[model samples]
Target: MRIAVTGGAGFIGSNFVAFFCKNHPTDEIVNIDKMTYAANPMTLEFLEIYENHKFFKIDICNFDEMENILNGCDVVVHFAAETHVDRSLQNAEDFLTTDVLGTFRILEIVKKSKSLKKYIHISTDEVYGSIEAGSFTENSPLNPTNPYAASKAAADLLVLSYLKCYRIPAIIVRFTNNFGPFQHPEKFIPLAITNAMENKKIPLYGDGTQVRDWLFVQDTCRAIEVIIDRGKTGEIYNVSAHQERQNKQVLFKILSLLGKDENLIVQVPDRVAHDRRYSLSCEKIQELGFEPVFNFEKGIEVTVKWYERNQQWWKTVKDKDEFKKYYKNRYPGL
Candidate 1:
């Protein structure tokens, strides 16, 4: 299989790429990334040693460039987006431009290509807003609360439209909160872990009771592989680890693993239009043989050890002016 992955330098994208390269050496994987502030090319540095892997530093909105690059690919996994909810609350135009317009362009190219097999759109459960009780099925109506979730919801609808109108071989995969190694420090888990590592206080929003089902990046990659091979066209699948944790609970786990003091957690203002909880039904994907293999306790332990060992990977990044500005701007009262 020839796979083209957008946002391949980002957290989950890199994880998928790495797993594909190691497990399926015979298949070719080409990655396209805009190399945004949240993305570090170094995360995908291992691609340098893999002959089957090729990477291009290009934005998804560049349709002409992406059209040529994605030609003849069997699958196109779209992951490129401005994904930070806090950052989106500050400036949402980039989110619309990158998430909406980018998807439109990618869809146009995929629709016109004869050799393309399936388009896997990576979406989020935030599209369903807060589900206080029952798990949201794939048919649940979208009710996005924040700009970031709204943008993703829009893109998800666009992908479905193409599948419906043009009969494109496309599937949307909505994943719950994902955390693992190589995640950008701007994300919640990485931010908490890294801050705790430096003996600095980790920021917790409001009462830190926002509930999100956590999915390990590796498990997500595995499900994507299953979808790539067995997923039905014009369908949507929910992938999760069934490990739901409150934001504060996740922080406590990280602190416990690192032997850090409980006082390191500082409560801050919550997100504007914050969703109280997001739970998804993963039955559809399970029918396709997708079950999360990693337990959150064990996965998080491995993730903490990774940050502890990978000082060079993120220390310089955290010290940069960009990182400082982002931290000051995003975390209130820091």
Candidate 2:
């Protein structure tokens, strides 16, 4: 099989690529990424030893380039997007351009592909907005609260439309919060983990009670594999580990793991239109025989240890001027 993965240099995508390469060494893997600030070559450095894996630094928005590269690929996993809610709140143009328009470009190319067997569009649970009670099923209506979630929701609809109008073999996978290795330091888990390593104050937004379902990155990768192997076309699968944690709880856990004082936390203003909670009923995907291997406790411990051992990796990312500039602007006092 020849698999083409977009945004494979980023956190979840890189982990998926690594997982796939390890499991199926003989299958040809083509990784496409825009090499954004969140994407680092070092994340994929280990793949250099794999002969069947290839990398292309290409923007998905460039329709011509995407069309040419995606030709003859058997499978396409679309993971490329402007995903940070805080960044999207600052300026929505990048989010709309990359998440919506870029996805449109990929769908255009995909609808024309004769060799493509599957096109998996990765979405997020944030698209359903927040729920005070009850988990959202795949049938729940999209109620995006932030610009980032709105953009992904638009892309999800576009993919579904193409599946019906153009008869493309496509499916959408809505994932909850995923945290593990190679995640940018700006993200919650990584930020807390790295911040504590330096004994720097970790920023907590507005009392830090927002709830989110956490999934291990590897478990997400496994869910993708199941979808590729047996999932039906033109369907939406909500993949979650059923691990719910509050923002403060997650930070406290990280602090406990690192033996750091809770005083290292700095309360900050909440994000614009921040959703209070995001929960998904994974019964749909579960029916496909997909189950997460890592619970929050085990997953978080593994993640903390990863940041501990991979000091150089996170350090290199944090040392970049882009990261520094963004950090200073996002949290001025911190």
Global Cα RMSD, each model: 0.9, 0.8
Model 2 lDDT-worst window of ten:
41-50
lDDT of 1 by residue, 274-328 (tens): 8999999999999999888999998998899998998878887797899899898
lDDT of 2 at 236: 95
lDDT of 2 by residue, 95-133 (tens): 999999999999988888888999999999999999988
Q: What is the lDDT of candidate 1?
A: 0.91
RMSD of 1: 0.9
Q: Point out where model 2 deviates above 4 Å.
A: none
Superposed by TM-score, candidate 2 places the C-alpha of residue 52 at a distance from the truth, in angstroms, of 1.7
In model 1, how large is the Cα lDDT of residue 117? 92
